[model samples]
Target: MTNIHAPEVLISEVGPRDGLQSVKATMPTADKLRWIDALAAAGLREIEVASFVPAQLLPQMADAAQVVQHALRHTGVRVMALVPNLRGAQAALQAGAQKLTLPVSASPAHSMANVRKTPEAMVEEVKAVLRLRDEMAPGVPVEVGMSTAFGCTLQGLVPEDDVLRLAVLLAEAGVDEIGLSDTTGMGNPAQVSRLFKRMFQEIGPLTGAAHLHNTRGLGLANGLAAYEAGVRTFDSSLGGLGGCPYAPGASGNVVTEDLVVMFEAMGVSTGVDLHKLMAARAPLKAGLPGEPLYGMTPEAGLPKGWV
Candidate 1:
């Protein structure tokens, strides 16, 4: 929502952070840099490049600072990193991340399992991160990706009232922007539209991206629904590459290349070069050999005369 009137939608690629963290193998630093450069060259304006978690917990993200440093060299792209707590946020800030995102799960069961904290406690952690951001990196935005915002695997059918309540708490807590995530990919189009409409009603312009997953094959459907409900930013991974290790049955995010095709073909400009974006998979595959990459567009190829 940086430029509300801009015709193009913002596709924030999260492959490096979300995708790599989900897999068993760690991508080498050099290959990660090359892959990021390829993505930037394809005209992705924003990317969640890394997560600042402990190396022991997620070794794939052990080189968080190094990746941030490399991604910063790309002039126009907004380099973002995920921070789990104030400590991670401090590391990200010191590493020169332009934007920081913290995941605050709405389901208490998911929250305790993932971060070992209650929903309310996670809010306090968010407040602490905000305070630290204000002290260390004053204008840099701190976004909260409300995980399991739609539903949870552990605690099924997360109440809508609970989701809205957390949104209000996050808004009042002073997060720069609050984005809803289908962390478990349990969201449907109608549910997505309804929740997003409620979110905008409650927080107005503070509502951010649609971080939907394709686990149920409704990622694009839910994304379109959110767009109709006024969400301009979308979070996707390069090869539909991410899932929460803590959230059972969670799998790939909405694919970036397919998303661009859907929006661009519908006359909604995404500002991403379709061919170049597709080519980014080269480095991805090179970096993580034998890892399966998913995307219908790549498998089926762009339709004849697709602009």
Candidate 2:
């Protein structure tokens, strides 16, 4: 068995894809590659490099194939990409992505608005991706992320049973792992603990992670809650760069720097260098000028004489 207390947690950076997609200005592909390389050098082993969505829908991801191809050349980094459906999966697989994440929203309204498919319909799509992975890229894991798993801006107070049901459905659909996302930043620490505990109890032994938003400023706390509930992998964007367009001003994913600092400070190793990780942000800032970068640790600075 993989030890639950494996010393440090795995923080998967989603800044390149999640962060860049939310902005109006698109970052150059070369700059994106440089940023990914820098993050890899900083000891970040997993990164959601880009999404394989159509260029017309998300121009920011126009060069996702190129980015994925480049990221594959890096050793020791698990390259992940988001695919809305089978077509994106094929593109990602052709580009050599080692892992693929498919989003299935728990909120009906959010689901329809985002992917134009209901949760159950999305599960069917997940099944299709799984089949394709088996036939084409055998052994490549397909992950189903339950967005709005905590709460939703469109359909508020998403039921726990609903989220768990979809997770079970995805597992039955043959996905390798399942993840819970607070896409609209509606999650709190107590809610996180309750939901994750129930999830593990009902769906024990399945790999799970927390993809939280700091919209309400409880991202790190929620992460700790899920971690205590046995979640080892965390999905965060460097500098907290994503947010729902429906909910203006709500920060998107949790900041990787803050998440890493929280764990490492508690004597839990993340295998990520704080200074080196922080340095990797320069390219991100340069790529998208005038965009606000969010984080507390980066501003407060590491404590003096503190190792």
Candidate 3:
């Protein structure tokens, strides 16, 4: 058997959900579908189309079911959605989401403040969702994203032990995959490496993706750090929407354009066509007029035929 480098990284676009959720304007369902179509055409294999929660809470995703249905029409593309609890998971499954992701806070305080539940409570919630999937979804995969794993505004310093412990609990709860998220964007390269290395040691193959924020301008660096530590999947938002409201002026997740450029420039294939990716931005912009878009690669213009 020959050793195969994982080829290219997987860029999971979260713009429709994370990006749109942060903005005041609700992107029209038709425009959202057009954007998703453009993104799929651009070679993004997975896209978080929406979050299944109370529309009163997040009016932006009030049409999550419609968006998920639209995404599912594109064969071969993984349609994912965010669920805060069993209710959202059930809705997403009914909407035909191939994967459902739940945000499990590592900090107890953040968990309570964000989801109104403790970490352990959230773990149980995940278990319940997993059970629902086994009985309902059957083939659908349930993933838990450990948010604020790096640090939190509500809680000053999050302990690594707590993060790892929650990872174990979530795993035992029967989640198919566990993802780490820098919700607060306080993550640095060193911290990222150490945490991921430790996580892999304990959870090993159970680790999934790194959901990073460009809040402090270290999103790409932290992503690289995680990738070097054997992480292949990455979560990013198109045009860097949905910045941490806690951290003003910071971009949401790592910019999809910048992440693709970083990987493709290094001869690592992302399977994402930069030209097509950039072209997809037009529809995204059209969908959310007046919303600020962020990306270095887009501004710098792809370095003269560097595909």
Candidate 4:
């Protein structure tokens, strides 16, 4: 397992990247840093702080390097960034990001549309990025969130065998870990559990985080399925800020506040303080005025007399 995952469960906050990218507005760097600070203070250990994409493509993440620099100040936070290719990886590493995530789609239709490459081609890209990682940032870990592993809106009903095969390919390519993503949010709990079990059988401990979206109102349920399937790390957005710009009908990521509350309530020990986590939403609201945020726990507040 990557040293980035600690405690019984590690919540990797992806709001700054996945959450912000899907939104229509570009939040200023100052407010972005404040939102990250609020997340860290709320005890999020790994925060996906930026996506190293071209400014024209994603102006919201135009200051990705600057954001990474700011997030690094938090003592215990493992600051992460997303990279689309070798160039993005270089930029993220140069910015001192402690961990990196790359999306490798299991569906060919999704792959070509999202990254302009096929599945096999992306593996080669992963190799290229690994070579660069070895050359530039030897110890920094690289993760691949294989998007559309469960299903795809463009292609429909991805084969579980294909997902497993690509995961094995990624593990053999020497990535630190490989995570499954319900990119289009079409996954059911049963499919989630079954596929993750097979992934474990194939890649062993190299299996990584679960990146489930709440598009069908199954994000938390899918997350529970992953945990029961032996996944310990999860990617979520604060206040459910996420959706794929490339995937039609893709929606918000599993909300960090709600996921933490679910796990903590089940005695799973996510290590996040619920009160502080709820308070962290303030910066998000402040950063992008009038942007709708989602979290049932935050909206309802903690239960009465239930510390």
Candidate 5:
């Protein structure tokens, strides 16, 4: 096995899309742009800037196109957007998103509740989206996030077999990558390691980011487990915002600042400056005045004699 402590890791920031969308208040377009710029300036190479859902469905993301256009200005950062179907994919591509992520729930119940489509139906949707991508934007990559890859609140203990099967199906459907998401925050370190190891074995290099939530307070532990399993990319939100609306008691993605601190402290290079990354939270707060942000590193300053 490769050294678990490999020096470089990619911390893909999802705050602009996942974090903001969970809040009640809608962040202004200019403020969203400022937040994205700040995150990029802090060395985040990839950011999910927006989701191309209907404005009525998620008013917070009403400015998805505008946010994607502004995010494109940051040449060093890869602009990403979440798309539920082919129309959303087309909008994202038209808005110049460099990467697209589509969520496919592992639990059949959660799938219907969240996207109103069964898991198999979602796979077909991915195929259609990929076909559209081929016609409209050939080079841009589409990633399928297997949400509820862990146990689901609606349907307990999502069989590992189901998750792996969906992964294979998505890979067969022509996705650029398949990321595992603990959408319900019901995963442990052991489960994370085992699942990610199996994922790499089944899909090889198509394995992508580990999207873990802190709802059960094991976010960092699970992240470390994935790292040990040779997963290099991680998906986290600033201030630990966002959760699946379809999953009860699911809240808070792994906090970006905290994840960065953990990796950097372990001598793993994330290329993200801790102070700059934490400071980016200022713009986030400014955007949504009353929204709450969570991160232990920010609440408690860096340790003494620490570099």
Candidate 6:
């Protein structure tokens, strides 16, 4: 078996932040930490542990600082936090977050609805967050995903040109990396490949992870499409936790266990253990008992003679 130190693909687990935020119940702090440890033990090098939003907006992440502090204890995993604006970024940096991801929605309506700011204003906010990171936590990478990149429930059929333009704008704003997000779970495989390709063309070295959801049940297919398009990093959740909270009909994120299986089966090293990854689901279920978990691989088990 190849070592995880340099896997062919990077699985960035977003269950803690993305998954937890969308759910109604707030997971206990200890349970959250245990889950993070479980994920790290399963070989996920990066984990979006918490979102630094106002407690009023997301009660589930009310303990963002605590979660970030605990997650940082894992020396191997890159502890990431999502911040909607400069204030949230400040809180995340103060809590010792290793990486920062901001959602800059492409749809004007989504931009306003999610963050109470226009798309252009969100870019300015990214610049502010970038400046703060430079002054306080220099070298802590900042990644921004163009949410609603494929389409939006508020605004149907987002123009491809608009998404590409936002990617370039974010790159120019000095964000360390730019990612395309299928926030609405409306993205198809063909669109996923083409948009990410164009994102690479525009941002080049800064093109980052593929943040796709399974609201429409195409998460794995879209992930494969992104991989073939040259995207190496993917954002997934343990049980495909709470889908895009901002999107009305969006369901869950790409399932991490299933995704690792898909990649490893294709001879692509995801650096995650299929056995341990599935086992990690215990803590997740314990944390959110009634919450529905989604993933085909976890339910079906590994195939006979699966590598």
Give a tens-digit lDDT track for model 6, residues 116-223.
Answer: 899999999999999999999998999998899999989899999998888888888899988889988899999999988988888898999999999888999999
Worst 10 residues of 5 by lDDT: 1-10
The TM-score between candidate 4 and the true structure equals: 0.96
TM-score, per-candidate, Cα-based: 0.96, 0.96, 0.96, 0.96, 0.95, 0.96
Specify the highest-lDDT model's number. Answer: 1
- Candidate 5 lDDT over 63-83, as tens digits, reads 999899888888779999999
By TM-score, the better pick of 2 and 3 is: 3
lDDT score, candidate 2, position 301: 91
Question: What are the lDDT figures for the candidates, one per model?
Answer: 0.92, 0.88, 0.89, 0.91, 0.90, 0.89
Show model 3 residue runs off by greater than 4 Å: 1-7
Query: Where does candidate 2 stray beyond 4 Å?
Result: 1-7, 244-250
Model 4 gets an lDDT of 0.91
Candidate 3: Cα lDDT at 76: 65
Candidate 2: minimum summed lDDT over ten consecutive residues — where? 1-10
Q: What are the per-residue Cα lDDT tens digits for candidate 2 across 176-225? A: 88989998888898889998898888778675779999988899999999
Which 10 residues in a row give candidate 1 its minimum summed lDDT? 1-10
Between the candidate structures 2 and 5, which one is better when assessed by lDDT?
5
155-245 per-residue lDDT for model 3 (tens digits): 8899999999999998777788898999989999999999999989988888989999998899999999999998999999889988755
C-alpha positional error of residue 142 in candidate 6 after TM-score superposition, expressed in Å: 0.4
